[model samples]
Target chain A: MEDPKSLSNEESLRIITQMIQTAKGNLKGSSFYFLLWGWVGTLGNLGHFLLIQFSDIEYPSAIWLITVPAWIISLLYGYRQSAKEKVRTYSDTLIAWLWMGFSVCAVILIFSGRFNELIPATILMIAGLATFMTGLILKYKPLVYGGSSFWIFSAMALHVEPVYGLLISAVAIVVGYLIPGYILRSTI
Target chain B: MIPDFKDLDPLLHSQLRLAIMSLLISVQSAEFVFIKEKTGATAGNLSVQIDKLMNAEYIEVTKSFKGKKPVTTCKITKKGIKAFEDYVNTLQGYIKK
Candidate 1:
């Protein structure tokens, strides 16, 4: 709108309504890292499982190293997103720190030297918590339900064979990450 | 025009400043570009009005770098919110009449 010396009350009210709506609309265009993390997570787990089950790769688990770059990408993406956003909501800050904590926890568990099913179980549990919290913050039902399903998959991971643990992770990532991710993408 | 509406905050009486304040009040803080985009104001024009609001202590302006690009963001202050609320209340009174 052009700058005007004087405006009627109705004109002033209209401008306020329009601008507030434009600000609110800006919050809806983000589903970037959800899709990123989901794809990387699902593919990484599947790759790990296939090598362990069908091939004699000396270190099938080494496939997880592929995610190392995803971490860098995630960080850089988050940094860029932060820079690009003109507004900062409370939920934005909370969700960013929440995933950050989840990343730290995952990193610690991966390096904890506990080569057992419990590692996957605990990791899934932590992942579930982060997903659930993010869903709550965003008020998205698909993610909320998907996050809840992670708990079920985590339990199943405990009873499966060690090689199947990789498969279970793949499934958990699919249900808990990819499904909600697709829905979020569609909504955006 | 009416006597009742005349009591509205003069700082927020103009269209662009009111729009800027409305946007800032909706979100915690907003950048200069975002404000300009939302309000449909020219950069120079928006900057002058923003400076008016800033000088009145109605909003806070922060200048920082988004990567190599310079960015300016603004947030409505407590005084600004009170003024906006008062303006709306006065307008409501005028309308109800």
Candidate 2:
């Protein structure tokens, strides 16, 4: 094994070059995660709007109003994090808060019967799958596998039992949001 | 016998140059601003270090326009990469207990 510290000028230069290349790879990996989550959040918001418009259920637009801001905040935070500062730690914290807030809102929606619409269910499943795939492509274990579980559960919930929707939502938030958020916080 | 550390080329072995090289190695390519930000070096210092690397043919620098902004990108040469690996291996011999 080569000694890094005592490298000659020529040798040290080579190592430095490798370090830069690795940093770039890391940046790409992290950026993919940020974009994937951002898209998931946006799709979730859109799903809510569609549910309100199509379903006869008496759901207030107020929940969407609240959730929209969270998604927006998360999206902006993700963008800022990708912009070269590597604010992964701060963005991860923000994502956790956003998801926790989302989870609470989802629970309330489910209990209120607002989430009974097929549109919301479909949206959740699609968003989950997309996130899962994004994670897989980047080999981001937290996102790839976690997102896959979220989507797989959502898909199953749609067919097997509707009540499982709530559980699926919870899993989505926990894995897709909370866990990755915390990991990003600690690792990045 | 291995060359003395002090005898190493100052252009390639300087602290700033080493930092720049390390960062370059990790990324596909990095911009001047990115390097400056990561290395915490002033523009003048980074420019000088980059110049040294370029002179030594250890790194390649390209200038381009990103939208309205002019961007400078740098990449490490294959020779530079091998040299770094060897240097690290050699250094380990001295430091390992």
Candidate 3:
């Protein structure tokens, strides 16, 4: 590292390539967020299904309240991650912004309160896009497939009754979110 | 033709400084400790090289407190990216010759 005056072009090229590779390879996947959302989404869907089918609940949709705690947990996890993450790679920044955009869009759709029947499809489509781009950036195939699975489920969800759609949504979270989330967690 | 070492950017010609620029260019930003670990440079040496880059406007260095602990982060500036690209193109010219 001292006085590389005698260093050859090949040596400089080697150093640049080696260091760039090191930086690119240093980023680990944020699997916790994915898994957390995956479980929460799955439960939210299944809870609605169970509450509606098994018990004569006054409001089955109220089961979606589970996301309240999930949001707090996600925030705490992100705070802890930012505290320890030494390198903020472009991929990380891009992914963070992508999800933030997704969240904003999702919130806008829900608050519009017009597409109540289309809510499940809308969520799946946005989730699919985010997951797909994330996989593309990270070059991870399982997540790429996971993202595609959401679209497939989205199509199926559209054709079913809202009650049946809940079950389909649960299965989608399992295949499209939870499975890939676990794979990402294990790989890291 | 033999390679013209004189044509190379002297700032980026050295081993450690070039390595630092190379690493910084690849990421959005990196912590001082992370750069040190990656470059395998000592803290004192790393600080000196970082200062040189900062003074040259080749990189931006920021210092802030993370709770009670101090943190330093480095990011390659636009000039740094341009210089690095030009250096690579120049090196490639020598190789192609």
Candidate 4:
């Protein structure tokens, strides 16, 4: 290998740029996680709403049981991808921790079983912050916009009926997760 | 145009070492295998350079067992971060000139 001193100024700059690009490429796999959650949440929200509207089921919230399988799949998928990831960047660690914190809060809220009509909005608000922070770190605009959409929809959800809140939740997922997820994928 | 080269740190002036530093700057810590794959350097060569950086106190290395196999992880020290930042600033100065 050539010593760094031997390289011209331009060559040095080139190496720095190349390495940064490579680091970013490593983050592309994260799109799968976003897409997975986005699609799953979308289905869950819509399914719950439809069931509540037309079905005579005693516990319409039971439709959310689908999240059990979704969570299992996400964990397995995340673990497999994690094992394959050789490099762990600073932003990567931060983003992971952010989501982990969100998950903890979410579980606690779900267990608390309070504010049934407000849960969806609360989740969206949290999701907005996470998505927005990620966008700022990565300097990706689409995600920032997506995150903003979540905040907007979350407010709208508060004004709507419980059944309608599900629809708002679904729209937020599509905007916040699915759009950016696909954009991140294409950049890879 | 000629770039000002006086401010460049000699320790970070080697191609392999520079690559290693660049990688370390972006992440909190990375495994030996990860650095090896990214830098495309052989284990012996990479180990030597890693040791050099460690001796300089620019990075810290930890050796632990993951299950039955040993894992070596490298992290940039505070000194390393300062050095990398200085090098980058110097580079930018040169580029600007």
Candidate 5:
């Protein structure tokens, strides 16, 4: 870049637009986290369904213990990715906190045992809001659509059997995380 | 009427510096290497320009060690934000003219 005073308006405007584009381009190749969660959630939900259907387990819902590994993996993965990041955008921080807040809410709901029946609707609503906000921040349309799908599923989960709600949640994960995650990865 | 280019902040008017500010504005902070890569500016030149911005109180530059290697990070200061916004508005005025 030359002296700002010497450059014409056209050149300055071009540089600004170009630099913004460069920043956005750098955000690619970061979908691995999404895919990780997507797969883990899918497995957790399906596992719960199977556990309940096949066996008379004393506590079939205990199958959710699968998420412990997901949490550990997410922590490690987040640290690794942070190490690689050259710039941490405001949107990145916002997205991270959004998910973290979601996690906190989930823990509170599950542990309190007060709204166990409403867990599916509550979780799906939170997921929808987080995904939608993330999509808006990143300007990613697929994720926005995915979030909408989650909202729709959340509504449906209320009417269906609680067991089936797990399946619906899994489907939501596939749409919200897997498909868009892969797309984001492929584009990078 | 001629465009009121005088409203532009001289500090933010340069090609490289403006680009750097533009990048920094969108993020919390960025590594020196990342700025270099994005601007395609030689490190020596970027460092010099960064120092100028720092001296002007337009940006904050922090030096720290990431493991064994020294890392430099740059963040836009509040002054820098004001200057950049003013600069953009000035540029818009020029465009409108």
Candidate 6:
């Protein structure tokens, strides 16, 4: 076998170009997943709005109903993608399980009438911690930093009035989801 | 007074090696294929460069099976990371006038 490291600069450059081409090809093949995620988010948001505004439902109650099916769908999507991506790491599986746990907690807290005041705050805190842990486990900087920010904001929001809680959630969605999603799309 | 390049040259200071070092600095571990794709190096070339780094004690390599296929993962050692930073600092000295 030829000494792989003994290539001239030009030969190395040629191989590097081929590697990049292969990566781009893989990205192109997976582009549909991006589109699917976008559609899922759009539908989730629409469902949220309908449940809150038109159905005469309480906000937390609305979230409970709306997020359950959304959570299921998203989990299914995640599982399928993880399998396809050959995510064999234990850390990846742990993150997936954590996400599912957060979703279940969110639904349960939303519907618990006796714990109405505490559940939202608890859910926010749990979600933030889960996101942060996911980011750390995956070693993805954006998620790590973004998730920590969410955790901080949610912790702070827990002390404030309900109205301010909504704003915190908005910021979490914007920074943690929207901004990062756009960045991912642009970079990859 | 600055020490000359002859006094302390980076052991794996080529462009591809530098690129590999930079990428490895950020992640816990990366697969050989990932590094090859990221650095745009051929498998053979990447394998060779990786071996050099491993020999220099800058990186640790693990060969494992991913289902039926063989996968090699590489991670920069603490010593390797410190060397990379030192190299960067030394390179900066030249341009800092």
lDDT of each: 0.81, 0.59, 0.88, 0.84, 0.85, 0.60
lDDT score at residue A78, model 1, on the 0-100 scale: 74
Task: List runs of model 6 lying over 4 Å from the truth.
Answer: A1-114, A117-188, B1-6
Candidate 1: residue A155 lDDT (0-100): 85
Could you give the fnat of all candidates in order? 0.80, 0.30, 0.80, 0.56, 0.74, 0.03
lDDT of 4 by residue, B57-85 (tens): 99999997765878899999999989888
lDDT, candidate 1, B1-97, per-residue tens: 6553458788899888898898888887888988888778889999999999999999999998867999898999999989999888888777778
Please list all clashing residue pairs in model 5, or write none if there are none.
Answer: A4-B13, A4-B14
Which lDDT tens digits does candidate 3 get at residues A2-114? 45367789999999999999999432646887889999999999998899899998988788888889889988888888898888999888988999999899889978999
Judged by DockQ cut-offs, the docking class of candidate 5 is medium
Q: Compared with the true structure, what per-residue lDDT tens digits does model 2 show for residues B1-93?
A: 555642334445566777877676555466788777777878987887788788878898898775576778788888777765665565555
The DockQ of each candidate is: 0.58, 0.20, 0.68, 0.47, 0.64, 0.07
Best by lDDT: 3
- How closely does chain A match the true chain A in each prediction, as TM-score? 0.83, 0.52, 0.94, 0.88, 0.90, 0.61
Sorting all predicted structures by lDDT, with the top scorer first, yields: 3, 5, 4, 1, 6, 2
lDDT of 4 by residue, A1-188 (tens): 33435877787777777765655635576788888889988998999899889999998888778889888987898787766666677788788888899888888777788877788889888989988988887788888899889999999999989789999999999999998899889888
Better of 3 and 5 by DockQ: 3
TM-score of 2: 0.50
As for DockQ, the candidate ahead, 2 or 4, is 4
Point out where model 2 deviates above 4 Å: A1-145, A151-155, A158-175, A178-188, B1-11
In the range A52-134, model 6's lDDT, one tens digit per residue, is 55687556344435445655766687666643452133454466578668767876776666665555456657766876776
Scored against the native two-chain complex, candidate 4 gets a DockQ of 0.47
True contacts kept of 4: 0.56
Residue A5, model 1: Cα distance from true site in angstroms: 6.9
Find the 10 residues in a row with the least total lDDT in model 3 chain A.
A25-34
Global lDDT for candidate 1?
0.81
TM-score of chain B of each: 0.92, 0.85, 0.92, 0.90, 0.92, 0.89
Clash count (model 3, backbone only): 0
Can you list the residue pairs that collide in candidate 3? none
TM-score of each: 0.79, 0.50, 0.95, 0.83, 0.92, 0.52
Best by DockQ: 3
